[model samples]
Target: MDGTRDPLARDERAELHWLRAENTLLRVQLDILTDIATGYAHDVDTILRLRADR
Candidate 1:
């Protein structure tokens, strides 16, 4: 008996594929957000340092 012929197995495989694709998308989004936050922090630090010099 081939596993592919089973309806339950096919549904599980479809769900697994969708979940993997979603996981990849979320990781990319997280990377973008992290870069934005890092840049914002650096900018704030530079502003504070410049103000302190005055």
Candidate 2:
């Protein structure tokens, strides 16, 4: 687009790209955190069940 030379337009595009990258990174981190939380919950439940059996 001819507007690429426009400073304001370029700045807006750069900011949008940065925001998208940050959003993607956050989503990945959230997925990892959720997996870790789920694993911990499962482990805790198992531990409780074992203790109850005793």
Cα lDDT of model 1 by residue, 1-54, tens digit: 565664558889899999999999999999999999999999999999999999
- Measured with C-alpha atoms, the lDDT of residue 16 in candidate 2 is 92
- Residues 4-47, model 2: lDDT tens digits: 66456888989999999999999999999999999999999999
RMSD after Cα superposition, model 2: 4.5
Candidate 1, superposed: residue stretches over 4 Å from native: 1-8
Lowest summed lDDT across 10 adjacent residues in model 2 is found at 1-10
Q: How accurate is candidate 1 locally (lDDT)?
A: 0.94
Give the top-scoring candidate (TM-score): 2
* Shift of residue 21 alpha carbon in model 1, Å: 0.3
Cα deviation in Å at residue 48, candidate 2?
0.3
